[model samples]
Target: MVRQILPISALLLGSALLLFAGGMNVLILPMRGTFEGFSAASLGLLGSGWAVGYVLGCVFMARLVARVGHIRSFSVMAAFAAIAVLLSLLILTPWAWVPLRALSGFCFAGAAMIVESWLGERAEPQSRGRIFGIYTMVNLAASTAGQLVLTLGDTTGIVFFVLPAIFYCLALVPTAISSSASPRPLARVSLDLRALWRNSPVAVFAVFCIGISNGAFGTLSAVYANEVGLHLTAVALFASLPVLAGALSQVPIGLVSDRMDRRLVLVLVAVLALVADLAFIFLRPDGRLENLVMASVFGAAIYAMYPIIIAHANDHAAEGSAIQVSGGLLMVFGLGSIAGPMAAGYSMAAFGQTGLFVTSAVAHVLIILFGAIRMSMRAPVHEAEKAAFVTVPQGRMATPETHVLAASPEEAEEIIAAEEDRLAEEGTGPAHEAAAAATAAVAAATERPPRVSEEEP
Candidate 1:
């Protein structure tokens, strides 16, 4: 394992530094904006702006990498991020920060993708899972540490902004100085909504709804923490703990999801999230401990939903197309992420801090209702048919490269063809029709010949 990781260590180091800066950059703005007397709506737009840039990056960053090469692209993104952070400090206004935040988002996405591309290239098939696991752990720890670092500094001054800028520059050092060769061009993602919906309505709907709920909380929770009069330490914990809890919760959730109908697990999780949302709205946890505990529960359910939804989608997806399916769902999630913050911001502006939970509750409720309806419509993909649930990091942090880390192309292709054939023998339904359409669409888009044998594996 040590030898396996040595080759990509610098790439991982770069990723860790990038995430640390990203984590701090994300937390600092809202906390500082609150102090700067920015409106809840404006802060919300900041989140929206980031999502917009992120979505754009997901679409276009590959082209940039293709044009400039990964090293140059990574360098450019890091420089842009550093500049964005510095400009935020200089201007100190919501309008300026919004665009700057967007720039930061675009840069962060590009940089992350580049590093992931490198990791993907270097990883051996046998050790890919271990590499991905370590990479995820490093990033999560770095990001958490970055967010918590704020407790040591004054948000009122330029220090917090400078810190992220410094870290952003630091992110460049490992990648820039590393001896590893650049990987192939980044994967291109096309979001075919009709096909995605046809593939699995439940996966599509749940992922989008999860995006809305998670986006709302992710952007506003810190602001919410501040409004509720929590101290800075509590506020930092409020933002970071849910992510930590969510990471830890994926183990049990993955085990359960792999065994039963993933839709059933999704419904259960959504209900739990809804319960947490209601608790926040009704009980209105004022104390730090009360809020912290609730956030952890809320995080566990919301964070775990994405991977389950992805796995569920893949279970229904045609062979050799899991990457495309995951990418499409991620794009759909990004679309929801862009809208979530804006809507949540308006709600918070109108309804106070509790509005955050109100927005989240509505999203989770929709997920539950829609998931149940889909459950009634389609038969569950049998336990043997299910794709293994790989743990994914939370929203926006996931990229196409991340999917490569989760499951190899060959592994994903082989997992379900046999079961799919069995299902076909049993009889065809809407699910079969949808899968066939999706398969055809993927074949056309990729310009690859469709696999002839359902039992090829």
Candidate 2:
């Protein structure tokens, strides 16, 4: 393991620095905006702007890499990210910060894609799982550390902004100095609503709702924490604890999802999230310990939903189409993310700090209701027919490349063939028949012209 990791240490180092800056950037903006008297709605717009740019990066960053090459593209993205943070510091106005945040989002997405692409190229098949696991752990730690760093400094001044900027620039150093050859062009992002819906209506609908709930909380929880009168350290814990708890919960959740109907798991988790949402809205915990505990419960339930939904979709997808299914759902999630923060921000503006969870509760309720309906309408995919669940990072941080890392094309095909053979032997029931029909429909729907394609860089 040590030998395998040593060769890619530079890529890991670069990724850690990049995520640290991003983690700090996301938290500091909301805290600073609240301090500057920026309204909740404006802060929500900042989240919207970032989501929009992030989606755009997913769509267009491949072209940029193809044109210039990976290292150059990464350096450019890092530079732009640094500039965006520094500009936010200098301007200190809500209107100015919105666009700057969008720029940061775009650059962050592009830079991260480049780093992951490099890591993917370097990893051998036998060691891929270990490498990916190590990468995920490094990033989780770095991002949490970044958020916790806030307790050491005041957020109302230039220092916090400057710190992230410095780290952003430093992120460029390891990759820029490395001598490894560039990887292939980045994966293109596409959305086929009809195809995705055909493949798994529940996965499509649930992912969108998950996006809205997660987006709202990710963007505004810091503001909620601050407004509710938590000190700086408490606010940091409030924002970070849920993520950590959520990451920790995936192991057990993944094991259970693999053995039974994934939609059942999805509904169960959605119900748990709804309970948390209600607790936040009604209990309105003022004490730090109460808030932190609630946040952890909420995080555990909400964060686990994405992978369950993805696994369910793949259980129904045709062979060799896992990348398309995952990427398309990611875009759909992005669309929902664009709307989430805006709605939550307005809610808080009109109501109060608790309004953030109120908005999130509505989204979770939709997921729960829809998931339950879907569960009753369709039979569970037999255990033999299910795709093994793989843990995913948080929604905002995941890209198409993450899907590739999780499962290779060959492995995906093997899963599909094995499931198909099992269904064939068991004889097709109405549920299996419907799933087969849906798979055929998705193949036809996806046969349309490519939204975008990779070209040489």
Count of steric clashes across candidates, in order: 0, 0
How does residue 196 of candidate 1 score in lDDT? 96
Question: In candidate 2, what are the lDDT values of residues 338-383, reduced to their tens digit?
Answer: 8899999999998899889888899888888898898889888988
**Could you tell me every candidate's TM-score relative to the true structure?**
0.90, 0.89
lDDT of 2: 0.83
Taken over the whole model, the C-alpha lDDT of each candidate is 0.84, 0.83
Error of 1 at 318 (Å): 0.5
**What is candidate 2's TM-score against the reference?**
0.89
Q: Which consecutive 10 residues in model 1 have the weakest lDDT in total? A: 411-420
